[model samples]
Target: MDINLVLSELQKQNKSVYKNVFNQFYKGMVLYANNFLFDQQTSEDIVQEVFIWLWENAKNIEINTSLKSYLYAMVRNRCLNYLKSIKITDDLNLIDLNSALLLEEDIDNISEDEKAIIYRQILKIVEGFPASMQQIFKLKFVENYKYNEIADELGISVNTVKTQLKRAKLKIGESIPLLLALFLHH
Candidate 1:
């Protein structure tokens, strides 16, 4: 598919083109979001929000990269914001619990610096992956490319892309807790 042509049609508010792009990306976006959020419903909601935002701002939207990349980045940022909001809510609940007990202790919330450290650590871990795996991971998460897109770009099979991504996720997941603990303990 000619992504450029599709994007131009989208900018023109062509309903058929919009529907085609939505159909092409919706499932992939949801899956990409679910990697961060781990909740199917929240992932779906975030992807839907992205699509709605695209439709509403189609005329003014300026995408420098492929539309797939832009959409994936949007969903990724939203998921990160959602996670931060959840953390803040949890901290508030803890504060309320302490207040109910009449205790005057301080509660430490996750700071932005800590979040940055965690993100940097994760990126480092990804960098340590094999070249093929690293490329696949970046395409899937960083650029938000679908399996087919990654496969086509790399001249590999879709199954190869999926396998490499799965392996990368497992490796990253294993290291994340240790990285978080190391940073949070400081």
Candidate 2:
């Protein structure tokens, strides 16, 4: 099938044409995704997801290259993103392990009422952050969200999420010690 014809059908929202494209390219795209993810099921899922996204966004898609290249690039990008999210989860596990003991020691010593007081003060510090930074901070730390998840939910890029988080951490680090020292001393 001609790429231009397929794209033309796509713009017209032709379901049969979309199905034909899916049938033609699905297997190769899955294999391409599996090259990076090493998981057949996940690769298939990603490929299917790409097809869905392509279908949904057909009207807006502008392909300067061949359709094959565009579809392959989408699969490849999705695979890389999957790997990145996995790495982030692993890194978060390591961070959690490193911090658990310190948190446990300090938390064990504090009364529930005092902990509430500390939480309120910490919330105050967080509230003072820039709007976007404060929302990202709460979504990530308090709500236990991943960086990409926060970015997707907030409609920002991953780099922007990381930058905001870095700045938030610095600000929190500057504020938290005084609050902690006041509590930990008593």
Candidate 3:
């Protein structure tokens, strides 16, 4: 169960060796991940995922230095990414809260229930949009696609794609100002 033996076994793609490796490093990896991510469960999940990825990509993975250092580095980066995502979600939630606060004075005009209903309606509308439009919107908004990339994939002129995107945003702006505001405000 030595480190060198584990690495050699892993390089040879031996599945049995992973049990021992996981047992030996699981606690240390979780602790390392928790240093950045703060949540114990998330840290453990990230560590597990990193180990799984290591196993899957073991053939191409060149361990020049100690396996421990490599594993620790992977755990650290994954933890940092998890922390960053949490920060982003927190910021978006804060914007939603601020929007609620701003609309609070007109409570009778726009109740929280009404806001939820409107959001659901907007989601339905997006679902009903043309497949091409839906894909473009998802790539641009959800997957963060660049104009050039989207154009290349869609096999359309850049300006035409940009125009379509602009029209889509304008339509959304008019149909669902709250949702558009939230996206832009973020």
Candidate 4:
């Protein structure tokens, strides 16, 4: 399928072209989203939402990259936003029960762009880890694999998986302050 031609048709609100694009990309998008979200249903929903948005804004949407790249980036940003919302709720629950209501309001007010920046920064840090640690971290977090599953696939012990993940997290934790400082100063 010629993505450019399909995109052209999409901009004209052609259902056949929209269906073709959906058929070609939907499953791949769902799998890509699942890598971040680790939930089949949520991944499908996110991809569906992206397609819906694409259809709604097709006439005004500008694509500087391949359609695949744009779609994947959209999925990644949405997954990060979803994760951040969950994290905020979890943090609020751990901090104070009474403040939960207030935090819920604040959480909804948090900027998605800021979350995407933080997530990208974290990904940069993760990429700088040792190769083995990077693989372990990606398998554990990005791929949402259990320690034992990672160990089995990598032919390593569960303890090794745990130790490597701990090291990776520690490295990320140490670099976060410096990264945030630079980000803020810039």
Q: Could you say which candidate leads in lDDT?
A: 2
For residues 62-164, write the lDDT of model 1, one tens digit per residue.
Answer: 8788889999999999999997875522222322221322222222444666655655565567667888898787677656688899999999999999888
Lowest summed-lDDT stretch of 10 residues in model 1?
Answer: 94-103
lDDT of 4 by residue, 1-186 (tens): 566786789899999888878898899999998767656777999999999999999998888888888899999899889988655222322111123211233333434554455565566666577778977877776566888999999999999998997787677667665534443454
Report lDDT (CA) for all predictions: 0.73, 0.75, 0.65, 0.72
Off by over 4 Å in 4: 1-3, 88-186
Q: What is the TM-score of each candidate against the true structure?
A: 0.47, 0.47, 0.45, 0.47
In candidate 2 the C-alpha lDDT for residue 108 amounts to: 49
Give candidate 1's error at residue 156 in angstroms: 53
Give per-residue CA lDDT, model 2, range 55-124, as digits (tens): 9999889898989999999998999899787553222222222253123345446566666565555556
lDDT accuracy of residue 185 in candidate 4: 50
lDDT of 3 by residue, 1-186 (tens): 366677778878787887777887899999877655445677889999988997888777777677788899899888777767644222222223224423333323544555555544544455556667766765665456788888898898789777776666555546666653454344
Q: How accurate is candidate 1 locally (lDDT)?
A: 0.73
lDDT score at residue 1, model 2, on the 0-100 scale: 64
Q: What residue runs in model 2 are displaced by over 4 Å at the alpha carbon? A: 88-186
> Model 4: how far is 76 from its true place, Å?
0.7
Q: TM-score of the candidate numbered 3?
A: 0.45
List clashing residue pairs in candidate 2: none
Better of 2 and 3 by lDDT: 2
